[model samples]
Target chain A: MGYFLRVNILETILIYVVIPAAIFGVAALLTLVPGRAKSRPKYHSGDSWDYPAHWWSGDNPVAVGSIPDASNDVTFGGARGTW
Target chain B: MAHGEVVASTPLAADWQEPASGPLGDAALPLTAAQLELLDDVIFEAERITGLRYSVYLGDLGTDTRNMAEGLVKGLGADGPYTVLLAVSPGQKVVEVVTGAEAAQRVSDRSARLAVLSVVAACADGDISGALVNGVRMLADQAGTLPERTNW
Candidate 1:
């Protein structure tokens, strides 16, 4: 009975811990794919998960003749100065 | 009628809450007036459409989602009821959406992540405001604050 109980405890740990860890490991490995991969930042641990850059280049919602230059908005409004 | 007694006029001041300015009254969270203005616009537009306090920040932090999780704790300047931080860097396209303690309880990480992802996607497409608006919609949807029908 003692041996059976130990075996059950081991099984529980394997079921709850090991499996999830393995799944996460696999998921992390999958991140290396070209489109799926995250961008590398020097000295920063965080990776930039990229999407299609310049998703709306054609329409140009903010016209070139608008009050403020649309291109300036991208640099000033969105771009982070720190990074 | 020639008393020559002058009466002092008392001016009535309007009781209104003026928007606070400068570093948001917190040293830890550094932000400029322009940045605050942008965030205020986002919040105003978002609240008008979704009724949520949309706060954004720009700062450096750790890697992975963990950094954002940690940021959720220290996003806002003042210790308010709730705050959300959507940090973005165009050069790297690195974005992180961090929700405060109170906000975390109300907004799940997955949903918040989705919202951020949506915005990131939009930024990639070159629609900053559109991205933010879409992201706000996602958050509203997650919080069930979005209208039931598409009419609204």
Candidate 2:
């Protein structure tokens, strides 16, 4: 019957096309979401000096007499180089 | 129609922390006692030769390493002109050599660049302490004391 044929056509479309398309679309969307590919932090494992606190603070490793005063203007000169 | 069955299931596991003996721990301490002694000797000799206060700082500089280094140089007080501060942030792969105004007169920007290059080369070879010592020596040699009877 024509009715039976129509039902069969609709079922075929839903099972073979609609369901597969929906699944594929969901998989594509999941891949595009943020935080799925996180990056690791980079740190160097080498000999380095560890100051108790910021150098300006009182607990500097260098001698107190040798420490330079931050108030002086002469301390400001010099070129910065990056490696 | 056959019923849909759950064939397999995988549990989502939480992130785990690495043990101290792992790669992270192995890379924590970069210098040995011998290397530290070598650096101290080099610094002393460099200061004596250049008549400049040479200080070395090795650590992270947070976000703005230059500003932090400059601040450190400035904090050396009245000895500013005679001070040369070397700040190295291995994590960030940045090295800043700041010379006081007077120090810069002797150790020019070009000289500083050369020292930085030396440090970079050594660091590339996994010689952090050696790089510091070599760079300091180069800077000292470049900024050597003026002759006894020299008039500029």
Candidate 3:
């Protein structure tokens, strides 16, 4: 006769109720990733933008850094306009 | 190399390469990946068609937009005289087309102005990618139609 009798009511609640509740709470918290991804902002005119400057060339595109201020400002005449 | 192969009328896969290193290491772009890729393709195609280096600078153009734009074109260094630069300052709501001496010979001031106008109109409608593509295409088309260089 092999006896395995251990069924405390509080122990049962801790194993079946408390542990699962903690696990479920943690799992629910971890699943909030999509909400973060969905928050990538889109640009519209008049909206204050905070993106860094970028320079694109077909051959040598550069993710620009502290651009030098144009000195002696010569008008290299091309075309200028506003939206 | 422009005439080396059959060119597609629409943008195919552009050789959009990322710089190996930068100050802003892989920062998220305001535009989506697809938007950046499309701009890349348009620039590549424009360069191929006209044999003129086409570059774009997007962000603030400072208080004096023209001076900032002109400086950027000059920043192209040795390729300066052969590049056509479209510098757009969206937050400031201004756009500039700066063509170097060699490129200016092919794309006139009037034509560049017209292209800038198209860009501004598109930007006004809040279509940043469309604005750039339209400007680049118009400039390329104008320069590509020369009878002597039917390199296409």
Residue-wise C-alpha lDDT for candidate 2, range A1-83, written one tens digit per residue: 88777788779899999999999999999888865123322224443445322221111222222334533544454455554
When 2 and 3 are scored with DockQ, the better candidate is: 3
lDDT by residue for model 3 (A1-83), tens: 22225666788899899999999999999897566445676567777667888889888332121223322233354788986
Error of 1 at B111 (Å): 1.0
lDDT, residue A82, candidate 2: 52
> Where does model 3 exceed 4 Å of error?
A1-38, A60-75, B1-27, B145-152
Candidate 2 recovers what fraction of true contacts? 0.26
Worst-scoring 10-residue span by lDDT in model 2 chain A: A54-63
Quick one: best DockQ, which candidate? 3
lDDT of 1 by residue, B31-149 (tens): 33443355455555444443334554333334554454344434333322244445554445566665544445456777777777777776766554555556655665664443532
Ranked candidates, highest lDDT first: 3, 2, 1
Error of 1 at B25 (Å): 25
Q: Is the docking of candidate 2 incorrect, acceptable, medium or high quality?
A: incorrect
Q: What local lDDT does model 3 show for residue B1?
A: 50
Candidate that would win on lDDT? 3
Per-model TM-score versus the true fold: 0.38, 0.56, 0.65
Give candidate 2 misplaced runs (Cα > 4 Å).
A1-83, B1-29, B146-152
lDDT of each: 0.46, 0.66, 0.76
Cα shift from native, residue B51, model 1 (Å):
6.9
The sequence of per-residue lDDT tens digits that candidate 2 reaches over residues B39-129 is 8788877665556778887777778888888878777765666667777777677888888766776788888988888888777666677
Tens-digit per-residue lDDT, A1-83, candidate 1: 78777678779899899999999999999787755112322222234433222111011111111122221121111111121
Clashing pairs in 2: A45-B27, A46-B30, A47-B30, A47-B31, A68-B76, A68-B77, A69-B76, A69-B77
